[model samples]
Target: MAGTNRILVIVTSVGEYEKAGYRTGLWLGELTHFYDVAEQAGFAMTIASIAGGHVPLDPESLAHDVLADLGTDKRYADREFMDKLTDTVPVADVDVEDFDAIYLTGGHGVMFDFHQSAALESLIARFHETGRIVSAVCHGPCGLLDVTLSGGEPLVRGKDVTGFSWPEEELARRADVVPYSLQDRLKQLGASYSTAEKPFATYVVEDGLLITGQNPGSAKAVAEAVVGRLR
Candidate 1:
């Protein structure tokens, strides 16, 4: 990839799930795994959030078991990498033309804020209309809920896609806490949604320039799919 190949990473700024009384933000592995893969592929990357400044991390995502399984301990300890989370560009300030791709990384926090940001929806729409790749993993697809194209059609309508599944949410015991089931919302928006029979498995789908991952475990696969398209 050339130096001009740039990617914009969208993370949730919602620090806590107010209704559930739990601290939540971006899932650490979701961002780190995707970032590591894209960066190593030679794409310059920028981190941005719904709200600028420090981004919260879902505490559970940093738990020992999760970190060990994801094999991201070194990234977790990277001071420079971790610093990027401390401050992020506000979505409103992002120039959609500068990025070749827009990646939405997820955590439960996204369920609350991602889908509600008009600025993000506009950015995604522009990226889509301009022939850039639009990708998301886990609850990050929540951001796609209301994006409308230039023709006023819902972006996900009639598109084959996948995201955090309803069964996965219920399995994680967050079904009631999350604002809504992401899979259900995607289906309601006319996206053809599907996922692995097993929760948290690596499952990625690409429909045109749109790429999506089923869960955090699918982050790298999703990034690779984007890289494949870009190449």
Candidate 2:
């Protein structure tokens, strides 16, 4: 009951597929920016994953060019951040209603595991029912695939949301790993998914308790929206 203001962040534990084989997990910078904004707003935060342990990271996203202008925060190396990823609670072990908000963080890895997990589906449903903020960014939104409200409609139906667009995925694709596009899936779920002109530009949509960010560039904006909800 205490720490009622804490936010629960979900990241994917699965790495790149054995066949496609490229590094992937939570987008490091995106998660850090989100935690920074949430913590600064005085909300405690905890990280969770489908498997409950260490999450992977995408190697390409760690390049100097990507981190140079914007994603360079050292929170990526912080002990606290590292601890959260390694010791994350399993989605099945946590009570979704304990937190005020749930933010799904993403990387290509999420496309591999976030969508098919029943544990995540249950959590999202509970969070939605409680009217708490339920958000995701980039491939993170893939996790929303199975979330159905009490009436059995896709939780995102009629909601204003955004995620990694198909074009962006094509632009960022590696030769080996190909992930399902979040943009397409969200539209299929009846979400009014919208975004900015390009993939990396910041874009976010807020519809009641649902919020989504388009890509890594939108991490800060996503955090700001979560903070806005709390206020």
Candidate 3:
């Protein structure tokens, strides 16, 4: 991969959803799909987490049925890829200048930590201010909630964006378990949020340098959108 094609992939370090009494972390499909797309486009990728080391995988994302259906599950079994998830760089150690784009991967676990990191928020702002591509999928958009550009305006304000919808959250039966509704928060931040008519469908919204996806199904589309922008 060329130096100019470097991409930073950020995933949550949080491993469990205590309130829901279930394991939750990076949604495997979300990260895997986007990663495959980016890598095939000749981009060098680095995995990072809010707290660093041992990024967790949401158990639900690794269900046998889910893995079998996607067929791309071999990515989960790939030793090199799995090893990368075992030890991710801390967000604080990341140099924003090294990447051409920054992507946020999501899971229910992100709702617990993605939005609360001041360091991650600052890195995102820098990425945006410098005109690098900023992309996220599903609950990944939660990371954008508190990001402000150099002029202090919310990054998503007045921008067209989409993430895991409230309806989808409700459909997943995690409405109460999540810390907050990502769709509602993005709307409150002044983003023009939209989604597919049905839950779990592909929906990608690109607003200049920022791109977002509505669900796991939208992950590849979101990455392709970012690749298009980079080109």
Tell me, by TM-score, which candidate is best.
Answer: 1
Mark the regions of model 2 whose C-alpha exceeds 4 Å error after superposition. 1-4, 68-72, 174-176
Rank by lDDT, highest first.
Answer: 1, 3, 2
Candidate 3 lDDT over 28-145, as tens digits, reads 9888888888788888899999999998898889988777645548987799889998888999999988899999999989988988999999999999988898999999999999
In order, candidate lDDTs are 0.91, 0.82, 0.89
Q: Count the backbone clashes (under 3 Å) in each candidate.
A: 0, 0, 0
Relative to the true structure, candidate 3 reaches a TM of 0.96
**True-vs-predicted CA distance for residue 87, candidate 3, Å:** 0.9
Where's the lowest-lDDT run of ten residues in candidate 1? 68-77
The C-alpha local distance difference test score for the whole of candidate 3 amounts to 0.89
Give the range where candidate 2 is weakest over 10 consecutive residues by summed lDDT: 68-77
* Superposition error at 154 for model 2 (Å): 0.8
Alpha-carbon deviation at 3 in model 1, angstroms: 3.2
For 78-149, candidate 1 gives per-residue lDDT tens digits of 899899999899999999878999999999999888989999999999999999999999999999999999
Task: TM-score each candidate.
Answer: 0.97, 0.92, 0.96
